[model samples]
Target: MHAITIPEPGGPEALVWAEVPDPVPGEGEVLVEVAATAVNRADLLQRQGFYDPPPGSSPYPGLECSGRIAALGPGVSGWAVGDEVCALLADGGYAEKVAVPAGQLLPIPEGVDLVAAASLPEVTCTVWSNVFMIAHLRPGETLLVHGGASGIGTMAIQLAKAIGAKVAVTAGSAEKLARCAELGADVLINYREQDFVDEVRKATGGAGADVILDIIGAKYLNQNVKALATSGRLAIIGLQGGVKGELNLNALLRKRAAITATTLRARPAAEKAAIVAAVREHVWPLFEAGRVRPVIDRMLPLSEAAEGHRVLESSGHIGKVLLTR
Candidate 1:
């Protein structure tokens, strides 16, 4: 098997596509012949040696993939050889073949092709878990998604709007915000020039957002608290702006808001399986009905994984950048 391996962490140039031994499925796992994988912010951090794979997981960088089941391991059931599926992985999706725990596998949603399906797992799971399952974003509420043009942000906008919530997004450019608006975001704020706190408050008539899906962590903490509505929920999923920040506890207390920070990659298999199940039950029908779809910016061959990383690092893409096998 050939994969984008990192001999030493540095930049996009550090992703080396080279031959590696193929992985064999373990107990309750299945071997997936990779079709495609998507670039993510976490991949950039992993390439720079900042985020290592969870102990004993694959050393490669991809966190999700679409592929077919080539073989099933001991104790695996219900799925069979030649099953077309996508999976949420702890790592190793960058390779041609990856051993995936059966519990994390999902059938490609109807009407979505194999390669494009690669973009669905991680973003869908993350949005569903945080926005719906954890935050309990209700109908008629407002959801403010930071990094609205990115994969998670794009998915958050669609899902929130599908359930009758007004969506607000902060992107770095007007074009990015325009794309967010096409995806059903009601309030689009260019984070580069606009004060998102004031913009969101104004959009919601001074009530602020009922839920905020933030990727920029500490840099927006105090501001996020100030932007929340009464009894709002703030789900922090990334720390792109640095890890440390001051929180206004008095303001948060006044709003009676709640905060939760999570990463999908570090979760146990059972927990990931639960999220996957919830996505299949709730989100898949949205795709099947043509209400939502994967927003891919472009595709590059798996051997050109470095280029994919460069695209993401540049923040030049409107949505997911895929590396196809």
Candidate 2:
């Protein structure tokens, strides 16, 4: 088996595809012959050595993959060999084969092809867990998503709309904003040219966003608070902007808003299993109904994963960049 390994992480050039020993499924796990994997911002951080894989997990960077179950280990059931599945992984989706916990695996959503299904797991679980489960974004509430054209952003837009929430998004360009609008975002702000806090407030009639899904951490912290409606929930999943920020305790208190930050990669298996199950039950049906779909920017050969990383860092892509075997 071959997987992308980082000898000394620095840049995209650090991802080296090389031969490695095949991974065997352990108890409660299954061996998946990976057909495709998709890039995430986390992968970029891992490639730079800022983020390491969880203890006892695969060293490779991918967080989600679409593949077929090749073998099941002891105590794994309800999933059979040769099942076409997409799984949420803590690490190791960059390889041609990965061992996944049975609870993390999901049947490929109806009407989605295997290759594109690679884009679903990470974004779906991220959005569903943060927006729906943690924040409890209700119908008719306004949900603001940063990086509107990103893999998570695109999925968030569609899912929010499907659940009857009003969606708002911020992107750097009109082209990206247009894509967000097409995906059912009601409010689109060009973050480079407009103040998102004002834009979101104005769009929501000054009540502000009922929920904010933010990727930029410190850079948007203050403004995100200002953009929130009373009792709003701000879910921060990425730190692309920076890690530290000054918060206005008075503002947050006045609004009765809450801030929560989480990373899927570091969560316990039971927690991830619960999130995956929620996604499979609530989100998968949206895909089957054609209300949501995987948004892919492009696909590259598995060997060209470095190029895929380059694309993600460029921020020119509208959705996911996939690597296929």
Candidate 3:
């Protein structure tokens, strides 16, 4: 097998595609003949030596992939050899073949092709777990998503809109905000020029957003809190900004708002499996119904994974950038 390996993490140039030993399926896992994988921000962090794969997982760059099952490991059932599936991986989606936990595998949704399905797992699971399950975003509520043009942000926009919620997104440009509007976003704020706290409050008639799906972390923390409606939920999934920030407990207590911080890659296998199951149950049917789809910026060969990283690092893409085998 060949995968994008990092001999010494530095830049996108560090991703080296080279022959490596093929992974074997372990207990409750399956061997997937990789069809495609999607580049994510976490992959960038990993390549820069800032993030490492969880202990005992694959030392590769990708976080999610779509592939066909080659073999099933012991204790795995209900999935068979030759099954077309996409999986949520802690690591190793960059390879020609990867061993995945059976529990994290999902059937390719109807009407979605193999390569595009590679974009679904990570974004879908992250959005579903945070916005829906944890924050309890409901119909008629306003949900604000930071980084609206991103893979996670794009998916979050569609899912929130599908459930009859009003969607607000912050993007760096007008074009990106336009893309978000087409995906059913009701309020689009260009973060480069606009004050999001004011825009969101104005859009919601000064009620503020009911939920905020935040990726910028500390840089936007106080603003996010100030932009929230009473009893709002702010789900923090990424820390593109710095990690530490002071929270005003008095303001939070006044609004009775809640904040949660999470990272999907470091979770236990069982927790990932549970999120995958929830996605299959709640989100997959939306794909089948044509209400949602993967937003892909472009596709590149697996051997050219470095280019894919470049695209992500530039933040020049509207959605997922895929790497194919």
- What are the clash counts of all predictions, listed in order? 0, 0, 0
TM-score of 3: 0.99
lDDT of 1 by residue, 130-236 (tens): 99999999999999999999999999999998999999999999899889989999998988899999999999999999999999999999999999999999999
Each candidate structure's TM-score, on Cα atoms with residue i matched to residue i, is 0.99, 0.99, 0.99
What lDDT tens digits, residue by residue, belong to model 3 across residues 1-325? 8888999999889989899999999999999999999999999999999999999999988899999999989999899899999999999999999999998999999999999999999999999999999999999999999999999999999999899999999999888988988888889899989999999999999999999999999999999999999999999999988899999989899999999999999999999999999999999999999999999999999999889888888888998999998
Would you list the C-alpha lDDT of every candidate in the order shown?
Answer: 0.95, 0.95, 0.94
Candidate 2 overall lDDT versus native: 0.95
Question: Model 3 clash tally?
Answer: 0
Runs with alpha carbons beyond 4 Å of true place in candidate 1: none
Q: Tell how far residue 319 is off in model 1, in angstroms.
A: 0.9
> Among all windows of ten consecutive residues in candidate 1, which has the lowest summed lDDT?
310-319
Error of 3 at 214 (Å): 0.5
